[model samples]
Target: MPVNPPPAPTLSGDLLTIHRLLQSPAQIQRRLRTIQDMRFIADQVLTQRYRSAGGAVLYEVSEPIFNTRPIEAVSPGSEYPKDVTAEGAAALAAVSKWGQATRLTDERIKRNARPGNELDRVLRKVVNTVIKHIDTITMSAVASAVTATQAAGDDWVASTATILRDIELAVADIEDLQMGYRPDTIVMSNTKYAYLASDEKIANLRQRETRDNPVYGGEVEVIGGLVVVKAPLSVLPSDDVWILDSMQLGGMADEAEVDPGYTVAEMAVQVQSERLARQDGWEVWGRRITVPVIQEPAAGIKITGTNPA
Candidate 1:
């Protein structure tokens, strides 16, 4: 029996199979872009260019008054009303660069059975890191833009009456600003969304829509005419829900031609695999350039204490 030991098991076949699972170059790039697109806050706001002449600082212009006077029928000789005075101001916003990089050793690349696109994985990591940083910055800006906050009590599900009232109040506050803006989007943490989806009141309302309709499946409820969405806890606090006029939020990015520009659309991952004299690995890195600004704070409201027990 000792002399009958079989030959050692070969791993080449398994390795080859695993190599086949590596995605093509196009697939890799598409996946990365898809991930970035999924960032809800980034997709919702307005994005503008930061021109090179703007320098490292950009200004947000504001006009406090648009002087509107009621029109009156003028007598034939009455002097036409004078044009209203124009008052304008700007707030300075400093732009900063954010970047992440990763290196893959030559040996590791050679050992990879799927070798042609070895650097794709490294670039993906860099892209993901940059997107996360952008999201964090945008979320922080949103939190700061909150002009009003309401307490939703311990449970929105149990306190349905209060919840509706609070939502209405939040919407009313935005309307009271008279800024020609309305709250059209409601964002909340995933935990809060789950609770709301399961609440008896919400379920009953959606029952008609979900009846025997595959396309209208799940809870399709709108509160106070605002479309509700679930966001990660990192973006919105688990204990709060935010109602915002998304149009009022502005984001800026620099173009590629701009010096020290930081714009997500212009963001790219650079790869260096050849001409390495000492290093034996491929270097991959990406940068994110952005300035998240609250163009109108009065357009957004945050509701707190909504966490379910």
Candidate 2:
């Protein structure tokens, strides 16, 4: 916490011009630091992440595809065991940079009757845009990183008989391939999740299994051995449901160095302000250097057409 925070510039009397805000590098940096401390679904779904800039995303194509192997009985004199190599070949995917920058004009700043409040709003939205963009990349990676698709035999929204079965089928779809990954998580839209909560069977189970049901408690717990992630419509703008082993789903590659006590995503952003070379105002720039990659596609399965038609 800052002892004496930067004063909010007023339109009149203590007029705070855009130049004043830009001049305070410490204040601008402090604000960005706090903003960088934020988190999103990309942070959760992409469980593997670290700080590193260059080089390709080296990963296993299929990974350990053999779920079970034959064991041989051996005498004291017999050989110990056979050696086995990991399934799939080594592949490389270049990490691409993703960033966005917004310029602040003095004319625009002057129009803002409440410069202090509006400036804060501007900075928040600017950084959030970049973060959301990163989240979208990861969502797209996982959504497309599936070779198996489980179409609901019955509409999940209306039919109760196959709701749980649908999830298991998606899980098995991945496990049956012997890909050495078991899905323990499911991601869906809030609308679809509401239907799951309203299911009579699920409601009864919640009622009998625990006195403090998630239904009445206003929270969702584990269901059918899978952690439920009801994502926002904007984040998951699809009718398709995803069940995956997040531990093996994908990872993020960061180009910026993370400072101690700060997240890689936070440190990935660099914010600075400089006088407009030709203009009368300052130009505030925000950039994030990071990328998300799906290392193993077989670790996930997509369940399509789960929403009501």
Candidate 3:
């Protein structure tokens, strides 16, 4: 059986819900996995391109294909030999060997010659080093997740933009969502006859076709809205940049309300600018990083329709 048609409002609303749902932890984890897989795929793509270049200068000047990072062992539970400590009976146990006991040459040899304090220092260093390595590994894991998160955010924005443009053409009507459609995608239309007095008809004659004119049959009221797109990028460590949030996707609303009677081409142009705004926003961010500035403002792009001729 074919899928049931979703009500018009449900189309945009459902997509928005899904987009918000993606920001949840479960979705975030899924995105992380996706990023790792894509990283591998991106590397493969670059490698293929490099090979296809066939001794071209393109591959030679390219920086490293990908950054290399060591995978460190991270374990909160590590077994340290309790008997290895140099104290009391444990110290005596450590001194014993299978070989013949050495003969005492001097009176000092018969006594306790090994300093307990010296042994404590060695044990402390060993514990400290293990703790340090554990911290290092934890940081690396977090950094990897951050990198993956940024990648996922960029992928989502770009992917969503592509899907929206493709799907926009297929959308028949959008306003039915907020007015007639309820929580369910069910569209309830009142086809019952209604008695309208002559006075009431004249009163509503002009009002009926405000923007959403001709309720019975008319040109679909397609409200134009601004399109939002985001891209992920990194600031050079030398720049000492800080992102309060690990990943950010920011753009204007999908449908920007305009004066209802504008030409469709004006709306289309606005949409196109919003699409380009994604690239512009990234460039603005890049420039902010390079220029010496005390603080960087949040970056975004706003697109508006031009007045119709």
Output the worst ten-in-a-row residue range by lDDT, candidate 1: 266-275
* lDDT tens digits, residue span 94-203, model 2: 66655555666667667767555556666776667766777777787777676678988678767544777788888887888765787878888888787777777677
Error of 1 at 219 (Å): 7.1
Judged by whole-model lDDT over C-alpha atoms, candidate 2 comes out at 0.68
User: Cα lDDT of model 3 overall?
Assistant: 0.21
Deviation from native of the Cα of residue 199 in model 2, angstroms:
3.3
- RMSD to the hidden true structure, all candidates: 7.8, 5.3, 35.1
lDDT at residue 224 of model 3 (Cα atoms): 18
Off by over 4 Å in 1: 1-40, 46-52, 68-73, 83-88, 107-120, 157-165, 207-229, 255-277
Candidate 1 structure quality by residue, lDDT tens digits, 48-151: 34442444544554444356665677889899776676554566676667777677666665676654345556656677677666766777777876758866
lDDT of 1: 0.59
Please list the C-alpha lDDT of all candidates, in the order they appear: 0.59, 0.68, 0.21
- Full candidate order by TM-score, most accurate first: 2, 1, 3
Model 2, position 42, has a per-residue lDDT of 74
lDDT of 3 by residue, 1-309 (tens): 665785345344544443333224344233223222111111111111111111111111111222345445656786532332222111000111011111111122112233222222322333233323332332232233222111111111132222223222212122222222111111001110111111233224345445544444433222112211111122111111112111111111112222222111211111000112333210000000000111101111111111111
TM-score of each: 0.71, 0.75, 0.15
